[model samples]
Target chain A: METSCHDALLFTAEHPLRLRSGATMAEVSVRYETYGTLNAERTNAVFICHALTGDAHAAGRRPGDKRPGWWDTLIGPGKPIDTDVWFVVCPNLLGGCQGTTGPSSTNPATGEPYGLDFPLLAMSDFVTVHRRLGEHLGIERWAALVGGSLGGMQVLEWILTHPSEVDNAIVIAASSRLTAQNIAFSAVGRQAIMRDPEFRDGAFQAQGTSPDKGLSVARMMAHITYLSEDGFQSKFGREAQSGELGHNFGVDFAVESYLEHQGNSFLSRFDALSYLYLTRVMDYFDPFATPDATAALAADPAKVLVVSFDTDWRFSTEHSRRIVRHLEGARVPTSFREISSPWGHDSFLLTIDDYHRTISAFMERAAA
Target chain B: METSCHDALLFTAEHPLRLRSGATMAEVSVRYETYGTLNAERTNAVFICHALTGDAHAAGRRPGDKRPGWWDTLIGPGKPIDTDVWFVVCPNLLGGCQGTTGPSSTNPATGEPYGLDFPLLAMSDFVTVHRRLGEHLGIERWAALVGGSLGGMQVLEWILTHPSEVDNAIVIAASSRLTAQNIAFSAVGRQAIMRDPEFRDGAFQAQGTSPDKGLSVARMMAHITYLSEDGFQSKFGREAQSGELGHNFGVDFAVESYLEHQGNSFLSRFDALSYLYLTRVMDYFDPFATPDATAALAADPAKVLVVSFDTDWRFSTEHSRRIVRHLEGARVPTSFREISSPWGHDSFLLTIDDYHRTISAFMERAAA
Candidate 1:
């Protein structure tokens, strides 16, 4: 899944601006990576948005990393986000666990971590940066913009906020809004973080302490939501994990191992503030709030694709269609597909042969 | 989902004998509520095993409680486990949140709340108590022992430990072994409780303190795994449960509210120690340890009825089938059925119609 960075420069985007909260961030650095070389006509740009914990690194086995990109199998030389012909660009999301200016990033003014002090970034703010990234490359519009889960939300928000910035938008396993339940989960996570003695109320920037336990608990909670019972049961029922429960509460279940891995690993490259900021973004997302707000996107609706998985209880297919219905009602050229995957919402990260084919075909059309 | 329990009698089983672990136990007190009349032939007695947090009260609608017994729909006077026919007995499991002796029960020796000092009881211990309860009532054996989740574990163990104790067992949304993942989850819950300052290393007994935060976290963690993602998506989504979370991680999703309700109410009635014990019981459940273990069952082999819900990913129907296959191979009269529900592992508690019929059919066979 490795493509030469210098050779695969399909496009580049960057910008700096004032946020909705009246906070100005200058030269907001957005270092992104792309796949495939663009034609002279420059009409084949496909903007792929990464999710909360994702990065510009989408489909590759990067050096120094033991594992490949989150969805390397699905996007390679001839993979779904095929670099064979279509230009696919993936940027590290703003307020993310990756290399964008996030909570973990040093605050230029304070010379300290932004933590919660980082201007409260919204999902719209994320799309705004995305639009700027697209504009910096001198591209009038993208052939398509795609993402899954939270990434999917950015795609929907991108279309809703700047409908003309792209020709098509694909949202997979994304929801119309962050329900109270989702927020409650995020809140609990945040609570876990804030309550962590190390967190110091998000002001622990100077301490360089990561609220590992709190974050682990948060991730554990999120992990539970991401998979279905069929997935969890098939993966890890009451099966004993290890260390004999330590005669005390230690790690036991495979699920716990998985969640602990996610949480601990998250603290390494991810910022606690980024979790706070990004979760807030998801909580505030509303794809169908108003006519001028979201319904109005149809006037020049970007061709949109919404896909959902049957077993993905996290952001079920119904969520995908809700986006499609709004897109269609707005006279947007939209395609809706419901794929079946027993892996739950995480299927987007897995290369279901059918999913790959579908993505490849969609990219082909977007390129044309 | 309401019924009068006037005809039912509550029975307390003797807690005599040293448990599997040499611990001073008096007559095992099993505070059970029974419905329906036992026939002269004494062949109509049926045992109902309640889930982890369920109680001996099966089908009573309190004037202001608003919520009936979790199994009110199925165990009513004319319902499937109909009090009108087979004599039904629902016993408070050995270590439960209800009237049964749990962590909250007074220690006869210490004359104080047992709390964590309460002996760590296993699933087999629950079965032992059930057997004693049945014996005291002159019930040579049950027509069938019906249970879901943890209760199902008891039913399975009852058949394996004392095959003659139950002619048939209806194990629902339960498993034969504690998956490593489930153990890990329980580990986190235990950790959460232990970490709470109020918990004081499970020595909160003398202080009159309860590990509210830890217990709540435990409940919150467990609650998330109990439902299907499809259930969460349909029920919560990013919707502002009651018009909130537009900006914060507060209770913005209905799922969060539901989880909160579960977690909050749990701390009130549940003993954090019992939660630890019961989950461990689940962790220790392994019905297929050795074939010889089954060879000892009564020559007629107890009839086994295994049931699971399609949506119960926590305990997939496959898990139940594994039990059916094992019991049947042992020449135990066995039946397997997978009921349909969207409630995930908790489906048995909510969707009782199909199970009601299944239990009724199995009980009728046992009566005959």
Candidate 2:
């Protein structure tokens, strides 16, 4: 499962790329990592899109690295998205902080980090940048587009936006559009980041201060949604901290400690403003919102495989069902399944046998 | 459905009222509201416990009030728990902010608000205070003890603490103990309040400042949990805030606006320190953890009716099942039903036909 270092790809828009918010931006840079080799016909290229906080690192360990890539379990030499047969390219999304043109990227007009100056991007904007990245790599089409959660949102958008560019798509633990409850959670997460006085109106970079607490709180709030109640109870029950109760406001339960750790550790790698922008993209995502949703979906050319977990309340099976129903209504080739897993929405990222098996079979069929 | 003003009762403890945290305060003031008349046998009094964020107001309107009481739908003359047939008493919980001796109540020794100086309390402490309020009213035994959420927690505690004092008990949307996920949310809420630099380590009262944003965030988080996904989707959906999208972080979705309103309005009524204290009480609740759980349940002479909403993920039906299992295991009279409702944990407060009917039938039988 060895992985290589990430490669930065400059994608300067020849013309201003107008955003959904009616703004335009240019000179976008997208960083990506590739594993395996593109076949001579360039037919075996698989594009992997990342979730909200994910990066281009999808598998393997870097030099002197102790942690494997996030999806290492499914993207290694003989893994589900086997690198031996498929040339896998994982790109950090636009409006992402990790080695990508995002809120932290420099604003060419001002010679400073874009910060709040970064254009409000929709899921379509993210797909547009990734499409440019793909075309730059000399690929005519993607053999498959695979993603989970926010990444899955991109996969749905890609199939709709560039039908001929992708042959097969795997949308796992994702939604076509967020429900009101979904939007509510995102709103709170954004509020947590914005309310921190240290945010300095999203120009904390210039002020040399970080909204660490707010971002931490935001991450903690999101973390709670990522896992199921059973997952939390199993991992950290009412199990008292230090095997004894502390009557004060400190971490009294194991879940509190776990959430605190998740919140603190996330602050080191993620940008707060990027969190705001990316989550907004999720909130605005609604490919099915138009009047002719069926006709719009019917135009998608990819063979779609959709997966959700039974316990994944964050992006429940109902979300997957909605996508499948829409796809079926559009007469698209779609395979949908709700896998049973205790891990909740995070089951897609873990080493679950059924999860891997279902995707592997679907990928094989797509490849054949 | 009319209402009356609240009456304040003071109990100067000859001995300190010991808390689960091993601390004690002597002078305690309990503010309560009573409707209807006590029966000649003094057994027709129904004790109503309030949840977190709820006050002593349960039914009827205050002087010149436009809005009816919170539980006015079910606690009036011809309502489910008819005030005609039963006397009702609702009390502001210990450590509550609503005219009760709580964090905002002045500390006798220091002649200042207790703030964080208020001794950390447990569910047992809350139950103890209400029991005193009952005795002060000269009730030999309550006809029934009913509550929802934290109020439900108190109901369970009272049943266990004084088996003979309560004749019947109805626990709704409550848990015998807090799940790890439950504790996680509470911890984050407390963190939201505590991390606000303005909190001043809970000395905000003395400092003449309030952790308004933090408390607001906390309320918003809890508000999300109180309603089910179906509940939110139906109520708000993807409705835009202004029939158009706003590219900024201010409230955009209808749910966002609703949550923001809920959070902001909650700040005017709830105390940050009490939010911390009460949620801690919930986190520390673990009645089944003790070795005497079987003995404790066996000792309860009350007829217990436990109700849960199918859509209530916050305190799911599983929580109610756990309580019923324990009571049944101890050979206590227990009736349990998981009522179907789209309102989630707040179903108990809403006007659900089956829900009201179930409680009405049970209360009638208990009175009989």
By TM-score, the best candidate is 2
Per-residue lDDT of model 1, residues A252-307, tens digit only: 55566676677567667667677778877777777587556655476667777788
- Residue B98 in candidate 2 has what lDDT? 87
Candidate 2, clashing residue pairs? Answer: B2-B60, B3-B60, B3-B61
DockQ of 1: 0.24
Candidate 2 lDDT over A1-368, as tens digits, reads 55655555454466655666677787777778888888999999998999999998888887876798889999978789988989999988888888888888889888988888888888888887777777778888899999999999989988876787888999999999898889988888888778888899889997888888888998999999999989988988778768787677888677888888999999899999989999998888898876665564477557999999999988999999999988888899999988999989888899889999998898788778
Candidate with top lDDT is: 2
Clashes (candidate 2): 3
Taken over the whole model, the C-alpha lDDT of each candidate is: 0.72, 0.86
Worst 10 residues of 2 chain A by lDDT: A3-12
Clashes of 1: 37
Error of 2 at A316 (Å): 1.3
TM-score computed on alpha carbons, candidate 1? 0.79
